[model samples]
Target chain A: MSRTQRSLQLAAYADGEVAQAQRAAIEQELAKSPVALREVEDIRAQRAALHRVFIEASPTAELSERIQARIREDRQRASGRTWRIGLASAFAAAAVIMMSVRLIGPELWHQELVSPPPLVARALAVDAVLGAHRVCSTLSDGTAHDEFRVGQKSIVEANRILKALRAMPKEGAALPDLSESKYALSSACACALVSNCEVVHATYNSADGVTLSVWMSDRPLALSGASKLRRVSGEGGRVYQVAEVAGGYSIVQWDERLASVVLCGEMPADQLLKIADRIQPFGSAARPTVGPRVAIVEMALLRRS
Target chain B: MSGKSFEEIALPHLDVLYRYARRLTPDAHAAEDLVQDTYLKAYKAFGKFELREFGVRPWLLKILHNTFLNGEAKKKHAAHSTEPQVLDTARAAAEIGSVEGDLRIDLDGLDDEVKRALEQLSPDFRSILLLWASMELSYQEIAEILSVPIGTVMSRLHRARQQMMTLLADYKFRGRGEPPNGREAT
Candidate 1:
């Protein structure tokens, strides 16, 4: 090859991308020409210099969370559009199923059908979307078993409910203050999908009768079909996911290091996002522990936000 | 691929992507946004192919580069004038006799000079150079990311290194082990 052609091939040779025959040819050129040898050395130096200069910036943990958050936003927007398109069709199909089941099988039905089951068997078998579906449609009443009063005012009541569910005790982590929210505390429940996998459900109602429920558990509900599920880094570095159920409700689930939380209501996406943003687990009032490395990271990011 | 597994594979490269993105767009905020947009796009379009460790880096970087280029167009901002400014500075230095008798670089200032010399190259040359030097991607992989033939990668890499060397060759180092103080040798 000519000197110029050989020079072009030298980079590929240095990068180990050239074929054996071409590599041999380039090696010959390197041996024969001192100028070519110097060129190769210059290329090596340039590579080292570039590495030293360019790759120094270390990305913050916030950057990863932010990237994940953007991905979640993109996915939600897409799935939201899909669900909107299928909303009418889904409702019609659901109505048909409900009517046919009710009309055909009186003996097969029970009053318990109106209450949310201890477990969303099918939803748990599928993903979180279907989990949301089961919670929204079946758990319409939003009542915690009568012992823990639905409208408890303090952390003691929340502790009572948590004990009932056998949830891990998180010092200083309390229910988000919703007094100024459009919704007020109305009902709460301790429900489980399977024994030992307890989830505490707290329901709130607005004057207009629109209800919002929050479920807190030790672990995020793990269902079989998880493709319908996603983890999002919500505002303030809170990781959450929004799954729109068949009914007109959106369920936003998140993890607070201390607990897994789910917020569900029939509200617009923006409204739900706003509520999610407000539901901080470790606000100044709570005075949460800053011991764990994870908690420290979360607290720092949340405080910044 | 599932979101969990995709996160496992892709999240580790967040810093790598951010570093490249920062170089592509000098503005820090713009670089962050670019990285965010790149991940968003990559996640939406990601498939089983990206599950492979080898394939994911180039794939993610391709998205980042394309996003940066498109973003520049969208914002109608000049595609970072650091290069032109550096070239102009170099030219004006030559004209005003910035180099006294010889082309001498203060040993401490070699890094800054090398960096400025890099900025003096066009985006295409700078990008190709950085990909090879900083990321150490294979020629085939760089070609794939840039959507150019492997031969083109070879040529560009050669030209980029040559340009930098030409710009830098005249500088005589002050001495070894001194931190760059950005001063001209008297």
Candidate 2:
């Protein structure tokens, strides 16, 4: 090697970076040349001087304490972030469960534990109407009833009962006029056939003495059953439950203006629904109608076997 | 890793790291800051550290080197208008034997002329000289710490020694009231 190359190797040699074989070679070259030996000595002297200069400069005594404090602070901040993330996750999970119960629990409950409200309401209406029809048939003779006095008395008695109960129909809604169907309004009174809630029982008699009974309640009646009933869509997008009761009676039940109305008779189901379509809330022409809104607890009860 | 275990294993190298940091930075406060940052980073990344044959000193040095470079980069970016050109001119002047006053003082012990000569070296050369002398790290270990090749480490150390010797010679001549560059005092 040339002198410059040999000189560069002396640096690595002084640093003790050369392999054992290279160390031996450099040592042999150093043995023959005073210039190479002096160069190595000068490098060592400079290295020692640098070591002494820097080794005397030490950090403050509190540097370690400061570093440890910083580490502790960092760890505390990380743990705080983890806690916040965990709390947020728990709240999010609870909200998801509540929304799930609100939106989907009722449907599953209806499918598994109880029949839907329309079916139970239909059956109850069938029983109540059948009983009322039997009572009215026994009470009334085959006489052509005076329409004006009975209609006027029906209104007076309905108002008196509503006043006594401290309840009013949402918009002055009264019994529908079924004169166009040849059924005259016969007798109207309050009865306790469906639950303890007061229900208005109104009977309409045709010229041939075919008896039809209608039941109206200010709130939804609570009923439970296992049998599903058929629903029919009527005019103005109203849904009606049509079902046949014992002793050849057909029932048509629907909701109007926060009141559940059930109409049942010994007539055909179609004829009953046609009569139902003619019924409307009496006072206001512009009152908005809403579908039945059953609470989740009310819809989730299991039917008694 | 647990903090206690990390302290047991790493705290012994605090003096070494601080010494090297002093060589790299301009002042004791900057050096302490650099050492604290190095320890914080090391603690965060402790889980990924494997106990190698060279131990944790080299690893800590690597973090210190990287943190110092990152700080320098941020400073360069913030002072983008004139700082870089000035640094370049200072480095060139240091190489050609004309160093500014600020780079010539600071660092206690030893002769004032020797301290000035030591301070006149650039950061890269000073780092190599410090690691090789004070820490006694091999060329391979220094290369690993600085993220450079072993050849570069060797050449930089050689050049750094040469520059230190030249600056010491100039300072010695000036101290004797003689003009530099082989001039007679008469």
Candidate 3:
């Protein structure tokens, strides 16, 4: 080998990364040439120095937790989209039944067989007509908390949204453990009245500008009109959902474990479902309550079931 | 496939990912962001990951490296207009004129000097050196992670070491306010 080629081999040999034969060749060259020997020594010293100087600092405990949390949020967000689409299709399929029921009679009442649980039915009926844009605009108009931002600001706004939804302690600065639902926390919110009941309007936008707006309320929603609904099994239980397209947007409305949720976006029904599926109740305080209205809806449904 | 499967296959490499990310990024915050983004992307694409065909470590590193490079390219593109290229000509002239100095590089303060020098190298060179030296990843594995040939890894590693030595030794020469020439006459 030429001197330059031999020298490169010496570097590999110093790192102990060379083959057995190449190692022997390098050792022989080192013995014959003092300059080559010094080069090898220098390389070894450099490696040693790097090993000593470079300290592999252990990441903080928060980092691993943060990473794991972010991953969970991501998976939920993705599957949630799929679930939403599935729910939407199910809702669309139920529409044919809606037509059949109309022909059959008022015999098959929405509450009797087909409607989702009560709160989900009520909020969705109102959400279909009353868009979340007005809620966001209300916040932007300075009637509520301002700064309707996304991404980094979403972290703070997540808590703000939970508070608006009454899902957390409304006063304290201590943030809820949101690693689970943190992915959908990417937007702003305001508590706005829909059909005479207060609801939290939270709009979460992905980094790529896909927006999923959620309308949530603690009050059990009563089905107002001949609402179309479908029963679909979700992560926790049998979630009732409504999927429809109106005003150039696709919307999915469902009952989460904690609140009645209505999700709207300019994407496919499935994409809207993905965001809806990820919208977990933030704290222990936000569990769904079986109120008198829900009891009445359940009684009517049970009579038919 | 399942959350348990994802945790089992991928979460074990979190430390490795974080260490390498620290080397790639400027600070802890950026490193955390890079690793978080990498894991999220990996989890999303886990359906396509064939664990039996390729190991998780190399796959995770590839994601981390790609995410970092894309962020870097974006920043470069953003700053490209504002950055002055006139300094390039001046720097090149100064590099060519550098002569070997007699001052021996002191090992006393080398820990910090070596670190500064490592950071001074381009991301490509620094990455190869870190993968080989710190992470102890094999050339074959690095080739897969970097999507480069084994021969290319070897050459880049050698050049990286040479450049590092030059930078480390040159620190003393530079302290004297002269052009650094620890470049050996090969």
Best candidate, lDDT:
2
DockQ of 3: 0.15
Worst 10 residues of 3 chain B by lDDT: B80-89
Would candidate 3 be rated incorrect, acceptable, medium or high by CAPRI criteria?
Answer: incorrect
Pitting candidate 1 against candidate 3, the one with the higher TM-score is: 3
For model 3, the stretches where C-alpha displacement exceeds 4 angstroms are A1-3, A85-305, B1-4, B52-54, B80-108, B176-186
| Candidate no. 1 TM-score | 0.45
Assess each prediction's global lDDT (C-alpha) against the native.
Answer: 0.58, 0.63, 0.57
As for TM-score, the candidate ahead, 1 or 2, is 2
Q: Which ten residues in a row have the lowest lDDT in candidate 2 chain B?
A: B99-108
Judged by DockQ, which candidate is best? 1
TM-score of 3: 0.50
Which pairs clash inside model 3? A80-A274, A81-A274, A84-A273, A85-A270, A119-A221
| Interface RMSD of every predicted model, in angstroms | 18.3, 34.7, 16.0
Give each prediction's DockQ, rounded to 2 decimals.
Answer: 0.19, 0.16, 0.15
Per-model TM-score on C-alpha atoms: 0.45, 0.50, 0.50
Question: Please, what are the lDDT tens digits per residue for candidate 2 over residues A1-305?
Answer: 76446657887788787899989988998999876776787678667777787787887889999998998898888678657655655664575477456545445433421233242332353443444455444333111111111443454454344433333333245656677788877766554444444466677888897988877776554222213357899977777877765456777777654467778788788888888887774433423344455433334443321
Q: Which is better, 1 or 3, measured by DockQ?
A: 1
Each model's chain A TM-score:
0.43, 0.47, 0.40
For residues B72-122, could you state the per-residue lDDT of candidate 3 as single tens digits?
Answer: 533543332222122332453354235323223545557878778878877
